[model samples]
Target: MRWLLLIWLILWGTGVEVRAQAMSRPKNLILMIADGCGPASITMARDYARAVLGRKELALDAIQVGAVRTGSVSSRVTDSAASATAYACGVKTYNGAIAVDTAGRPLATLLEAAKARGMATGLVVTSRITHATPAAFVAHVPRRAMESEIAVQMLDQRVDVLLGGGWAYFLPAAEGGRRADHRNLLREAEKAGYQVVRTAADFRNGVRRPVLGLFGPDHLPYEIDRNPQAVPSLAEMTRTAIALLKEDPEGFFLMVEGSRIDHAGHANDAAAHVLEVLAYDEAVAVALDFARRDGQTLVVSVADHEAGGLSLGRNVDGRGIYDWRPEVLARVQASHERLIPALRQSDRPDSLLRAWLGLDSLRAEEQALVRQATVKPDRWPVVLTELIGRRAVVGWTTNGHTAVDVNLYAFGPGAERLVGSFENDELGRLLAELMGFDLSSLTTTLRQQQPVGESR
Candidate 1:
């Protein structure tokens, strides 16, 4: 009986492989990343939508495929740079490496391959365009902190569509930005034919082939705090990128990231985390919808790592109660990060807290915590989230990322190829394979053109 079971399992695995090989190649690929989104985050969002929003399902629930193991060469828990590089360059590198190997050698990324093949390429994210995840796709650097250098390389690549924040990296210190070299990359970008748009209106109005849309000086506002008229949502960015890139006869490769979900997690803010994940789900829907209509498009949604070690249920106020009150989160109108300024200025803080947080009167200790966090700007997010999370019965184990595997969801052609467990780099190689390109050859060519051990 044991031998029979083993035989059946082997046959099933073989069948999956055969089907994957038999499937037609996808013409377009959209990789949607929810940074630091763990399994609990999805469940928390699903439950909130069901109980409060009255929705039946989330966009990601239907396409549930498998999971991916995220780890770097240096640590069991991977940072965004190393994990993203795993998906970009098909290599397991030390943390802080952006599309580079352990020896600090450059490796070609999927986006580079697509661009080399004359297909359109794009990167859209809620975080700065020069951040680790997006930077891994377009830039190579020894350290993830080299945003100014990453920005230069990104422009040199000439991606078809670029949308996100971090304009500060492109400007000089004289222009109130972080760049010390005094080089204005934005001006250089314009010279290279990128229509730079800062406002939402400009993004909507612009129809150019190559565009650079920097919506904020740093990371964009969290979803709950975002002003729709001022900044575009992740879904809006994904939709617009697809519209622009799909015009290519060959195809396109676009990466859309819900970057702030990770931030919310690090702060242990259950309400903010829920809102961010919801926004990401909307973006996933946008990609899935496009793939369904086009038939030749592949949509893949994944997470680099799980942050905050969030647990859905916990004892409230140190009581033995095991119940979780997701309704507590539903009443939150704004994120703790957004409420800091108003909180610092408000004369009647208790009154403001009750209104904004949808809470009754707060305990003296909770009020004291809020007041302390208001004065200390760096502590505001975690302090506020603690107060809200206590009420919601959600608990966080750590402020940093966890080593647990994250879920993978997919739709469209060759998705079945990824319907099982994968090491992060294996997933990257599989994506390159599905695209019918050789990343190794591209890496060789790129290495020959550039000197080894090059920094910045």
Candidate 2:
């Protein structure tokens, strides 16, 4: 066994292709996407894990193969919609396109192809089930903002397992949903033979096919603010999805996303970002464990794009600080978004910060900033993050996506196919090849089934 492993490593390092006959195609595929995680994000998480949690390394540390270039057809930086579409369809499209080509024509995605081949398919995410990354796999709309339409199409696809938030998009306005179309998709889902679940308890108890688990009305709570009793964590959802999908004899395809790491990055909250990445790593561990046990499974984890331009070391007041303090972030108990609301309602806002941020005492300037932001609601998050970030010695260049390349990790069968740096679309094509799915033929058939000029 050691000799065979050494031979495999030698072949991989030397760029010598092993014959197809010598390799077995994976019977199951698990694709995990960290929506806006980047190299710096991983470093921050690792530092926190080692310094505070006393862990040696992350689950992803052992399986990292290479990096992936994240750019869209329209710009060097990519958004969730186009970047996810690149992975789902193996094609480049505009920034807002969802599983559509640059021409606004619907394209077949890997999930669709897997379903066509009689495999069970599932999507698990921390974002709304109708959000960009997950939507790219099961629904094709011209715009990512058309979440109502996206929700309709997801049910039409009949994905075996659907787990996430965005229950509002599935119901009508009269029924406390955001939809103006007056369609109760929850009822529609029930009529279609789906077991709709809404709480962590119900989700755990469920053992049926075609399960739709919407734990919240919008995106699920950030890990810093998550209630384990009310909402299932990303790892829990991934474990459940695997349990349901692996029952299929033909094979299965599942996409699991750590959706809100991007949200924390956009807020430039180092404390929140650290917790989100740790949550995502936990989910990665779940996938890796299942893959290790089920040798016929292929597990690939990658980020679509980097967000916030996160920097580990920061220069303070013209003084070059050569150190970062992850211990400061370890003291944070809630996300800044959660604190903003508390700030708005509390008359003694300083007391709120003292309790939640573990700040026993604040400097005069820090107290003043909180007072000013207390009066001005718009600056609430700004002051909160500023206080935390300065202590942590972390900085962010921009509150948006960056063109920087992101790391890729893979394990299980055919992981060798993704061992080198490449474009995001190229990675998509490789994924299809590893699964032995003809994406080009699938796309052609989809185009023929629906006329090119039809509404997307």
Tens-digit per-residue lDDT, 239-274, candidate 2: 999999999999999999999999999998888888
Q: Candidate 1: give the clashing pairs.
A: none
Give the 10-residue window scoring lowest on summed lDDT in candidate 2: 15-24
In candidate 2 the C-alpha lDDT for residue 187 amounts to 91
TM-score of 1: 0.92
lDDT of candidate 1 over 1-456, digit per residue (tens): 999999999999999977766566898899888999999999999999998899998999999999999989999999999999999989999999999999888999999999999999999999988999999999999999999999999999999999999999999999978898999999999998889999999888865879999999999999988999999999999899999999999999999999999999987878889999999999999999889999999899999999999988776656755677889998888887778778777777667888999988889888887777667756666677778878888889998999999999989998988999999999999999998879999999999987777754
Which ten contiguous residues of candidate 1 have the minimum total lDDT? Answer: 373-382
Residue pairs in collision within model 2: none
Question: Each prediction's Cα lDDT score?
Answer: 0.91, 0.91
